[model samples]
Target: LVTIVAVNQTGGDIPLSQLYAPNSKIPASGSANLTDYNRVEEILGDTSDLGRGATLEYHPDPNLLVAKTKDAPSATLDCSVGVVAGGTSDIPIAEEARIIAAESGLDVVRAYDVGVAGLHRLFPPLKEMILRDVDLLIVVAGMEGALPSVVKGLIDVPVIGVPTSVGYGYRGGESALIAMLNSCVPGLLVTNIDNGFGAAAAAYAICSRMMKKREE
Candidate 1:
């Protein structure tokens, strides 16, 4: 019969021979032996796993971590960015946000085509994100730009409003800009019209600060 000895170590498993005498004896079956056991115990006495520094060091893949670290600010904790768009036409702006966030080493999730006109589409993905606890939210919309206001009302997290120039007719893009500027929700922030990169950068700043605070 083979006996197993369990030792907790990080980075990978370490053989018993690495830590103990190689000439150690094995007990025979049915023998009430304490002689060999005592010797082993004495060698490892008073040394718990913690005391022995037996911990698994999680080293993220060098290539993956390096790529992310190259872009991210020198911070330890992970930050997340959530981007939402009002309609299909607004996707380009939302894509801009995603690209910027990704370049900055922030994990990004996208919720698209959830404009206020289709309220139901908004909540399912939005609710999922809220439950997942995103670090920041970017709301992109045009043609009245009411989506951000609605989002601000629904969630307490910081929302950066991006007014896309997707509208036409006499209202022009002015309607979107005015709607966002006049939003009733307190603490709702607005960026330049169609400036997805700016919105993403702002969100990255907020999330990076949060990560730094957590480390402190």
Candidate 2:
């Protein structure tokens, strides 16, 4: 049982006090704002009552949830890919890439905080990933943007470089993006600065083509 909470940004967290039945003083005819509606906890009871285990899926909007789930199964079997982030600051961009790939019906393996500053940290998993034959790789980095180049040198597979906007001072993210764009190695592709979603989309397209060729 997963409890998912979706709240309107403008409407603050609902207070516990306003959940009761309105009396004459409060006027039951008054508009009930979602902002005023406080805490909601779903109590999942034992499955014995219904002859099955309790697996309650709650959606804030029932119609949208139903439509989404109906298409989810068929949409989830398209591609297998890997996402490697250079550092902790790059995790958000990496996560965004993972989310985009997953939503596009791809399986994603996340390798995080393995930047080029610590060269030894990147080799083992990278070698293993290359051996396992991931269809495509998304290399996410910020500062120097050297991870993609290193990985490109190590493997023959296509690598898409993602430069995050996490650098400081005069260098800004432009320095990292330029570094990636200027990579001397071959088979290294690049997206705009901090464009994780775009990088993931490009990887998905590449994997999809590979899958199609495999099927043929």
List, in order, the clash count of every candidate structure: 2, 0
Worst 10-residue lDDT window, candidate 1 = 61-70
RMSD of each: 20.2, 13.1
Assess every candidate by TM-score: 0.64, 0.65
* lDDT (Cα, tens digit) per residue for candidate 1, span 115-147: 988798988898888888887789999988999
What is candidate 2's CA lDDT for residue 150? Answer: 86
- lDDT digits (tens) for residues 1-216 of candidate 2: 111212111122211123323110111222121111122231223223212122223233211111121112224445567899998888877876775565455777778888977888887888778777777789999887888998889888888999888856136578778888999999999998877757866876676666678779
Cα error, candidate 2, residue 94 (Å)? 0.6
Q: List the global CA lDDT of all models.
A: 0.62, 0.61
Report the CA-based lDDT of candidate 2 relative to the real structure: 0.61
